[model samples]
Target: MSVNGDSEQQDWPRPSSSWIDKVLFLGTGTSGQVPAIHCVTKPDFGDCAACKDATLNPTGKNRRGCTAAAVVGRSAGDKQESTILIDCGKTFYSNAVVHFPRNGIRELRAVLLTHAHADAILGLDDLRAWTMGGVIQRHVPIYLTQECMTVVEGMFPYLVDRSKSTGGGDVPTLQWNIIDKDKPFTIPASQGRKEVHIQPLPVLHGYFGRSSPFWCLGFRIDSFSYISDCHEIPADTLQLIRGSQAIVMDALKMDRHLSHFSFAQALSFFASFSPPPALGLLTDFTHRIEHYATQEQVDTWRDGMLAAQLAGKAKLSRSVGEGGGTKWWSDIWDERDNEHQMTIRLREKYDPIDDHNISQTASHYIPPIKLSWDGLVVPFDPRRSPSMP
Candidate 1:
């Protein structure tokens, strides 16, 4: 479905009281997560740097859970803030135990599931903590596509149809709402003046063939968009999120995979925007991605793109390594893949339009492209803090 784009910065009205105060990155890794069992438990220890770092430092940027987030805000005239969980994945319980109390997230107002993958919906049973024993006064509402709801019903029959529950100490009371991928819907209102509006972005995740592709959803809320998993975004879906102020996209690893975007692919998409998003963060990473090294790699690419725009160059010739190499990028460059070619084409098409915003200090037009870690918190408004390391 098409949602209006805020092409011009002035067109976005500043909210006196932000509808969304902040977004907390509950988890930022793929289903397997960081510090994989084999990586740390091997006799000689595995060679994965990200997993090793996560093992040594229990609470570090290298440590990550599943890809999930919480949208936190207090609607107008509400006494308490409402938290809408984006995805309750495999590590939802562990992630919530640590972060929920630390961030003052007491109650879950609603849940929005992107899809019914194990990493996205396996934690449905854990919501019993809030629903049982009258911990939460009312039944929790969950919104998902009809296909996803069907999967949930199969996986957690007790959760969907309470009559099927047997010998249950306590089961979560829930209300299911089936959503349409082509429609934009609103979260059920609480004691508030406004309800959060969400736009569903259906994109390809994986496929059996050209005609039958697995559908995964990305969501658009105000100026923020989150697509935790995607292989390709259709042209129409791309237009829906064109002028987003802040975005969290999937960049699984340095190499192109069948179902997810690679580092360069995500970078190319981010840079294709007119002025680029104010804040562009990458998530859903794999073990191959070491936290600090990936950050440096992204910084180098973002800098090169900004430099090309500033110089009015049609191609990027900023090679940083010796023998015409470019450090980390050179190591992962796949001549067989078309990612490099796509990057060049995007520079030729969108670089000229960003000329007016590019300057000697090019941080304004060039969004900070960060490899988001677990527990990283960012303001929902891009104008408040546009750049965060």
Candidate 2:
């Protein structure tokens, strides 16, 4: 799908009063998830970060799970605000249990999809539990491209086949809303006088130059854009999200992937979009986020990142929402992966958008990227955010 972002920002939805800013990082590990059942810490890879993290944090945020998150209405009063949930992945059930309890949800308005990847859509079955016995039950809307919708339907025939009975327990009640990548759509606002309009920014999900590009979506909702799984962000799509202050994207692993972003690929994508400053999802972890050798791209990036942070890289870490407190991100890491704001600033200093810089960045990356664990929530402002020059 081709989307022209000439002046699409006008279509963005205004913020509402009923919603809160908190984005709970539900799951951040990839498909196999961290602490893979078949993980070996020595032979092939080195010390297991997943196992180490699990040991240190235990039930805390250092623990990783499937990818997903919940955005709740931030309120302390009597009125229970509206609830809007993003992707419901494989670990969404467990991750939700860990992160969703903080913001109590009264009404679930819609479900947005990045793509119908299992790591992104598996927990859809669990959505039934949310509607099981509510006083005013509602069929949550599932928004996605027709291709994705068909896949979802194929996976769960009973969801659409009315004649099919729910063997015993409750099945997820849903309202399938087919989405067009070229057209922007609006969902009921949770806390504002107006609705929240989400613009789809279509980008190629794999390869720099593939025989047939696997084009997928990365959404632009105000100042924040989310691309859960993708390998390449075309020039046009980059321009659309360039203005976002906080952009969350897929950082499957430090390794190269087939259909997902590798360490360098994700960094390059982030570099193009970062407006002087910007920072950054999830999927599998077992075979994906393998032990990083000292020479791995992620290790290099991490080392460079630490150095930049120590040297006072632009203060990129900002509180995402009102109630999230400082520990929110780590708790989630205690939960997913993405880029850093430093890469943007550092790349600008490295050189202008020249072939040399792009070449340097692209040279290390081997295409056909795989992905990692999921579960993360971040904050962003659609209206008031900086833009790339």
Instruction: Give the top-scoring candidate (lDDT).
Output: 1
Top candidate when judged by TM-score against the true structure: 1
Q: Give the alpha carbon lDDT tens digit for every residue of 95-183 in model 1.
A: 99988877788788888999879999999888888888867656778989998998999999989888889895478888898899878
Quote each prediction's TM-score.
0.81, 0.65
lDDT of 2 by residue, 1-389 (tens): 00122131232223222233544556666666666555445543345655565545555333566655555443334244455666778877776664455445445667887776787788888888766666435577888999788888888777766457466746767888888987788775444434656678887776447688766777765555667667666656766765554455676655556777655455444332334123342233333343323124333443343333333442434543111112112221211233342121223121122222332343121111112222233433433433222
Candidate-wise lDDT, in order: 0.72, 0.52
lDDT of 1 at 166: 89
Model 1 local distance difference test score: 0.72
lDDT agreement of model 2 with the native: 0.52
Ten residues in sequence with the least summed lDDT for candidate 2 = 321-330
Model 1 misplacement above 4 A: 1-18, 208-211, 315-365, 381-389
Candidate 2 off by > 4 Å = 1-20, 40-46, 55-57, 60-62, 72-80, 189-193, 207-211, 281-389
